[model samples]
Target: MNASPVTIPARRGKAAFVAAGQSIKVINTHGEQVVDTWAFNRADITEFMSMEHTRSGSRHIIPRVGDAMLTNHRRPILTLTEDTSGGIHDTLCAACDRYRYEGLGCTEPHDNCTDNLAAGLAELGLTPPETPSPLNLFMNIPWTPDGEIAFEPPISTPGCYVVLRAEMDLVIAFSACPQDLLPINGRAGKPTEAHFVIA
Candidate 1:
């Protein structure tokens, strides 16, 4: 493990390898930025973390500490070991892509999580077979009993974080989500950087 925390630059992505039994501490540095997270088997990128599989296995919309995040093949890849960020995270939202921004009326190219994931993996001379739905950390998406959900500012405070233990040797990736058009990042509509430390 490195002695220093690594930055997930604002509106960008970062990835690293985590051996089985290692834990990653993801910090909500600014209290507002939502980090879209993914994990892939070190030996086979095609067998990546699957939020659907995890949800089915855990039987929860929002994973709690102790929940095992499963891979596409129904194997445990990561486990939620600790959470101090108000225990709010999303398991249903798909990573943002160019089409997402375009639908929001952006005429110019936007930095998005899908592209971010590819870029992060590319740095390690790796590539994901496909973009999977991400575990959105510190994201606030409240739902109604009737099934309606709305994006809202995160309730987590600065310096709060969550720790996830790797159940298998894998590559973990993160994106400091850049959704300024919505308050998901914050009511101020500003995106910020986050940090992570492996231990």
Candidate 2:
């Protein structure tokens, strides 16, 4: 309810392609929420991201502050930029639909999560999900010593933001985690904010 002053009616699940030098700021209007992010060279989406590239170069499955988030090509797509709470954000958790949620305990049918992701791509004029895995921004999944990851509480506070300056002409897509069963999005459900400022 206390989103930043910017008015973006199409905020949820929307893909926005900020130009080569633009900067976008994501705000967690509510504290301890998770958001997912992915970037692609505007020239070609197929030449997109790969898990091997991002995880190998930085925070592994859990991204930390000031780390470089690399693309599959070993190029820096985005720097960690800023992290407030230092809570772990997952690079391993995939977006969940009703199918995936059923196991997580959502017995009824719903498609909002996938719809939110699709909203951005649709607005960007790109096709459906092509990347094998998505890069989650504020979501937390605690890493175990045995090499397993667990979804954990959010590390961000209200108004905490991560800033990304476009390294290339990038089509950045993000989802305010619509995880009804997950803690990061706030099980109560509220709107998240995305603000684009020209770099």
Candidate 3:
């Protein structure tokens, strides 16, 4: 366990304060939770993780061990060091927002990952103009041979986790996705806890 671990409850957001050389482990406490994660250079928020840049640099949509998470400046910010869940993880999907759910017949205001991320980072006294699309850990969005994209139930079981090592000091923010319309969270629409440890 980390000296100061944090847990983001289902349908909420939180931040993990970490430094360069430190590692962060994201654990699906109750399983089937898709955590949307992103990070910013602690010194400069302008230099933040860019999924587009990572894909361009790594040349793979589904990252593997040793893949560098690149920033908008095309610099490595973190590296995927370990993964206990061999299921699908997504890099191209954008975090859900209020408008997304409204389109899905959600009449009431919905808690969303984008807002959660902003709130989490605000707790650190840092705010970026916009939240970048995050690395969707444990998500199971697959592209089919017919060039169609499908949002399927997560393949991750309980206790699944992934470890990422920071390449630079970062203010990492993650949200236990509050998407109630998808099977990404095991068809429960109920978010689960994610154990975040920085060591």
Which candidate has the highest lDDT of all? Answer: 1
| lDDT tens digits, residue span 63-85, model 3 | 89989999999999999999999
Top of the candidates by TM-score: 1
Go through the candidates in order and give each one's C-alpha lDDT: 0.95, 0.63, 0.89
Ranked by lDDT, top first: 1, 3, 2
Residue ranges of candidate 1 with Cα displaced over 4 Å: none
Q: CA shift at 182, candidate 3, in angstroms?
A: 1.2
Report, for all candidates in order, the number of backbone clashes.
Answer: 0, 3, 0
Whole-structure CA lDDT of model 3: 0.89
Error of 2 at 101 (Å): 1.7
Q: Encode model 1's per-residue lDDT on 166-187: one tens digit a residue.
A: 9999999999999999899999
Task: Give per-residue lDDT, candidate 2, residue 10.
Answer: 29
Candidate 2 global CA lDDT score: 0.63
Better of 2 and 3 by lDDT: 3
Query: How accurate locally is residue 185 in candidate 2, as Cα lDDT from 0 to 100?
Result: 60
Model 2 lDDT tens row, 1-199: 1223332232256566667556667666666556667787778776555556878876466666666667667776666566554545667767665577778777686544466667778876787546446767677777679987666667667777776666677777766656656555654544355443334
Alpha carbon lDDT of residue 124, candidate 3?
Answer: 80
